[model samples]
Target: MGKIVGSAIVSHHPGLMQCEDFRRMMGAGQDSDLIAGYERLRHKIEAVKPDVVVIFDSHWFTTGYHLVDGGAHYEGVYTSDEMPWYLYGVPYNYRGHPAFALDIEAVSKEMGGYNRAIAHSGLERQYATLNLIKHLRFELSDTPVVSASSCQNCRPEHFLQSGAVIGEAIRRSDLNVVLLASGALSHRFVDIDWKPNHPRIFHESNLSSPENLASDKKAIALMQDGRHDRILEDWDSDFRKAHWEAFGAHYLQMLGAMGGAECRAKGEPLSAYENARGTGNIHVWFDA
Candidate 1:
């Protein structure tokens, strides 16, 4: 039988792909360490030996229902429509486990999840999904992937319900699954002319502020302590102040899918606190 062998929440910044060149020009080498850290996480993922990856893409904001990518295989030269200058000419090709994705879709509807099928490979790939593939070196392996969209209209309760349904699907399947929640912690973007001297730009809702960083720390602390219920409760007010991506919905899904599996999770901080267009970019892996 299939099971959720592992799960993770990661930042999928577009700059990650071109960090070497981008950071070198700005006289900063922090990105090299960041890249290596992700390399280490990739090794950890390999150790799990997952057969398929179910990615929750924060950028794939579906309007009506939760859209699941159903393509048998995905292949294309990806250029980020949101930030083409950074991600242009990026090539990605990955096989898709359509059968597994279809099962997820069916199971979702059975549990009252507003799940819909999206089977086209040509649809623009979001950075959150593509960047994870890039950083994890997923293309190097043949493990198929399916992407789940973030429902724009989903309430916290409904979204959490949806996550539970997905967990049930994974449990019933015969494929070993790894769940990836793809997004940043804070998401206020810089709206300024970026210069090499002031390489790090700040959003008006500044990310580097002591309060924001402290809140992020608290949030991470909760995750490390396996206090997912606390995150779910505090996300709307306290945690949301830090401007988590999708109001921390991606992380909620990651936690919810654990099925209340009580674990005193040990975590690894994979990336540094960098600025991705004024958003706070960091990767912390909480082992399931």
Candidate 2:
């Protein structure tokens, strides 16, 4: 039977794509911890030897239903329309696990969830998934990947339901898998004009507000303590109000697959919580 060997909440902020020298300049002469964190996270993943990595892409938003890329393979040069100049002409080539994706769709149908697997190769790619692949240095021939989209209209529960379906699907398949929640904590961006005053954009002081910073730290603490139950309980009342990226669906879904509020996987910090354009970002690994 297939099983999830590990999982992580990782930062995929565009700043990580910049050249090392450029990243150092932005980090006040130090490299973003996320850079080194990727290496650490990759080593952990290697230890588990997963055959496929499933990414819950916070940036690939769908409206009516949850979506998963089931394409056979993907090969292309990508340029982020959101920030073309910064992430232009990037080459990417990777295999996709179509059978496993279809299995997820099948399980979703059985569970009365709204999830679909799109096998068309033309499906657009998002940085949330691509960035991790690049930073983790996954050899294209070794491990295939599948990208799942977050439904924009769904609440925290919906994401959890979708994740449950994915977990069932994984159990029915034969491929060992790793789950990645590719997004940030507090996602409120600073005003365009604010950069002039906050030149060191990556510094924690540049986070959108003190409240966002505190909220992110609180969530991090809960994760470290394996208190996902508390985080879920407060989703609507507090954490949601902090404006987590993609409504925090990436994390909700990943946790859902791991048994939702029942999961007690402790998080190991791979990167220090930091700021990216006023949003909170970090990398934390959870052994499943």
Candidate 3:
């Protein structure tokens, strides 16, 4: 079966978006660096060295719990003058589930408890998942990296079943190294008022006002306490305000796969990339 190899994460502020180069090289340029953040993301992905990568984007989801069947097959995205990255056999696809099915109780059970687990796991309430497809390389012999699709949204209990499904996929792959989760700490910013359906990228001055101390402190406290409800509330409130790039469900699922163990953030916080947006791009590592 495949095993997690390594993982890399950075704040996805449109300003700091880092994977554009890879995307462009692969002919996925419909994307815009309207935010410089994409460029940095590519470096992060490269560092992970994943044969196949699963990305959980919060921007695309229904209100209820939902998981995209990443292993499902699809025709390669080729047309006109474009050649398929893999013109012969099968194309790569994503397989991890999103975090909608995971709730506070389920999270607690997975981690032990709010206080004990948070202190032990060193997890910030904010996080995301990036399971490496290479981990499932063995399974590839039976089920090559063909593509398919479906979305499922269920309760926490049902979510566990979903996790089992994903885990099974990994175990079958027979991969050596599996890239795990990576994401930010929180998203409250000073003077950043916002709304939904707003642009993903924006100007810096509109976001960098220094009035977000209260919210930030509150978030830190909730995280320290392992209060998922409060953490969710504060995050959603602030998220609506600045409305910059974010991937909450993505980070949460990554942390879930880590067995809720103690994790220490490894890098400096990069908060000024996308219009002075604050993201938990802090690098982290943990023991299994």
Q: Against the true structure, whose TM-score is highest?
A: 2
Q: Model 2, range 1-288, lDDT digits (tens) per residue?
A: 989999999999998999999998887788898899998998999999998999999999999989999898888988999999889898888888888889999999989999999987577889998898888876543589999999999888999999999999998888789999999999999888775235665778889989888889999999999999999998888889889999999999999999999999999999888898889999999998
Shift of residue 252 alpha carbon in model 2, Å:
0.5
Off by over 4 Å in 2: 195-200
Q: List candidate 3 segments past 4 Å from native.
A: 8-37, 63-65, 71-172, 176-205, 208-247, 265-272, 276-288
Write model 3 residue lDDT over 107-129, tens digit each, in one string.
33454432110111221111122
Model 1 misplaced stretches (Cα beyond 4 Å): 193-208, 260-266
lDDT of each: 0.73, 0.91, 0.33
TM-scores of all predicted structures: 0.89, 0.97, 0.41
Q: Any idea what lDDT model 3 has?
A: 0.33
Tell me which residue pairs clash in candidate 1: none
What value does the lDDT take at residue 177 in candidate 2? 93
Better of 2 and 3 by TM-score: 2
